[model samples]
Target chain A: MITFYEDALCENCYAVRLLLHMLAVPYTSHFIELYPSRANLQPRFRAINPLAELPVIDDDGVIIAGAAPILVYLAAKHAPGTWYATDTPALAQVTHFLTLAERLSATVGAARRHESGFAPTDLPAAHTGATRLLRGLDAHLWFAEQQGNAWLLPTPHPTIADLACFPHVILCEEGGISRQPYPALRRWCDRVKRLPNFLVMPGVFLTAPPKTE
Target chain B: MPDPTTANLWHPIAACADTPVGTPQRTTLLDTPITYTLHGEGHATAASSSMLPVLIRYGYIWTSLGTPTADLFDIPEYAEPDRRRFNAASVSVHVSAPRAVENFLDMSHFPFVHTGILGAEPHTEVKEYDVETSAERDEVLATRCRFFQPQPSTAADQGAEVEYVYRVPHPNCAILYKSSVIDETRRDVIGIFVQPVSQERVRAHMLVCVLDDRSDDETIKRFQQTVFGQDKPILENQFPKRLPLDPRAESPVRADRVSIAYRRWLSAKGITYGVIPAA
Candidate 1:
């Protein structure tokens, strides 16, 4: 049995959930609220996975942290099917999407680490930086739609690509951003949630100063 | 009412070889990162460390790719003047656990979440099913068999013989279209793969394969955008609640046999999460 650390929402956490369901791998949940942690990494979670990401997966004793690491690990070790491509080229395409998702602002869970006092960035300031980030996301999702759904890359199930973007994209609306105007983007989010294991991510997880509820 | 989230469980999918490339390929029982080009060919390996197919839910999720119809239009709302936007299809929306049940309950979606696509009205069609059962883990398997026909396309061989075989491991299955040719190829399948991030949410990828690579790629992209994009807003409404099983009071039909079977299968495997015994 595997133990997954996640809140009810959190697109990234949802992504991990999505992967678990597709694999039909049974797992227990630890709904870590992420804010009260000393370094964002919960105390017990630190023992299971040094990193404090909510989507950590504890496979019996073998622990993996981060959405990317946990997903890739399961695909490689536990589940074997359409999701993990065998060849290099096919896999490379998936990697490209994963890398790209990290940079997009429209993603559901990407909070300003600096604004939240989590991490510092190379950017000058976050006010304009935030705007730029959201626009960049809208453009990218548009680009995805324009470039043929297959243009960006192709993967069965949500793969790590969708997983990478799930959290930030899902929660972007909570950051005073609305996917409603970005019709295409809005649709993408909706489509993503419909996938098995797709949970809703709340902005409060990464909300400013965290929350009491 | 019980939460839909607790009704099923999913497992990580194993990678498969022969993921068609050239002419849009489909994923196996489980959907993941696999693509095909124009013909029944592409580049992919079974269980490559570079990337592997992961599973979620109890087993009712998969990854697939599709090439939409030849008409490029990223929904008129996307106001981007770029016509060259859009590529191919690589997402599917079926949620079922493998070997857990039979017949995905499409009837419910018709009147509920997917009403727009199905053009269904409210409370119009409530169905009940007569099901046979088999059990495993915290799941079950109810099944029935039938012959299916693929929507004959002009691009397809008119004289082609076809026969479809259905063995639903769970509710995450399709009424597939098949060709009777002894060496017939399979494509245009809606893959089901579930990844459980929490007890409630899962990320699913849906894909469709097209026979004609000659079809304009842009048109296909728009089609995919609309299909997947439409499903997003609706799914946001799902909220899982813990509840005991409702016996007899729940109406079902022959189609339900598959769903029941999948629940049994998961139980036999001890793949429990948040569901009651599918007795």
Candidate 2:
């Protein structure tokens, strides 16, 4: 049985879960909340993943650390034709998107942790980082619309790039980022919402007893 | 605007704006958007846009029907398309889910998800799918995705009929579909897009279709039943979460062209397609 570690609300974890579901590959989930894990701080968890992230999937001896790599690896092995590019040149493009995606994860992930944590934040630095990331997305989307939907490469199908970018983009609202004015994006979301085997990220419902209650 | 509609035909629907509140207008569903309010008492306006009108000499129009109680298939009226379409084509889907309704055009998932229907290979053929949008192309109310199945061998002709006609999102956002290949006269695809009104409770709309050619309605219904029957459990079981990509971490490929193009389209339109860009 494939056992993947994850948190309930972690954005990247949710992206991974969505990917697994789309592939229709069944796996066991091991909920490992990142907040204050005294027990999992043991050497075993760290051994599985050097970063100690939420989604360190342990499928037998084949341990996968990051959500991005793990997803591509899992899908490549299980649902190869759908998302993976068997071709060499396309693999390089996938690598580029993955690299950029990792940088984004680092920036957005840090900012989110900063907010979720009751700790102090370097406000100006955070803002600068977010602005830069949003700027790249803004230009990319704008240019794509002008071209009537030509991609970085000609795709015969939807690849990991589409799946990888989904979760964080939706969650950016948590950091006060709104994608309202982008008509092409709104339409695209409409399209994503249409695909089968899609899953929305789950989070805590606002209506809950106060800590005291 | 005098005769401003670019469509070759003039399809009229009920003008809910003109109708008084609480009164159900008898309207034909004109490609669904402008549900024709039939009763001359209400508005003769939403007449047959279809060159044909079947069951819709009358029906109720809701200014705001947020959720239906059960699946559209469970509805008695959905059993009869002739009554509603007045001989024109019509289809109903159960729920108003944004995703399931849209999958008809989301050709990306076919290889793994539905390998039986769509052959397991990279189909590089990028033909145009017509979108019926608002005058400004902002609102894609409907789309016509067309594709032809390749001939398997020179001896045997390899052409499979493929067309997924769409209607834009309603309050339910359920994906509704219609097909012309099943029968030139076939109306509607089976299934209703269902959404949960509460956590576990669902609202649905069942669709009926009239198959074309000599194949009776029963044969078409059986075929549809066998096919869509397989998808129901899987989609419903996929609740709560999906495979996460963390684009920040994964690589993309040329085969992802449609997905990449879609992502770009989304990011431009104010839809946050991924978090990688901003971070």
Backbone clashes for every candidate come to: 166, 83
Instruction: Give the number of the best model, judged by lDDT.
Output: 2
Model 1 lDDT per residue over A1-213, tens place: 898777443456666777787678889876564321222353765766665555677788887776676777888776544566567886886676666555553222344332222233443343345456556656766777776662234444445666666566565543334556566656566666565544333232211222357
lDDT of 2 by residue, B123-171 (tens): 5343556545343533343345544434211112344645555443222
Window of ten residues with lowest summed lDDT in model 2 chain B: B1-10
lDDT of 2 by residue, A1-213 (tens): 789777655667876887788888788876553432222355767777766666778777788877778878877987676686678887887777666667666565555545433123564576567657756765675676577653433465666766676556555544434556445544445445556776654321112222463
In terms of TM-score, which candidate is strongest?
2
lDDT of 2 at A94: 71
i-RMSD of all predictions: 15.9, 20.8
Error of 1 at A139 (Å): 4.1
Compared with the true structure, model 2 gives a TM-score of 0.40
**Candidate 1: what lDDT?**
0.42
Model 2 docking tier (incorrect/acceptable/medium/high) = incorrect
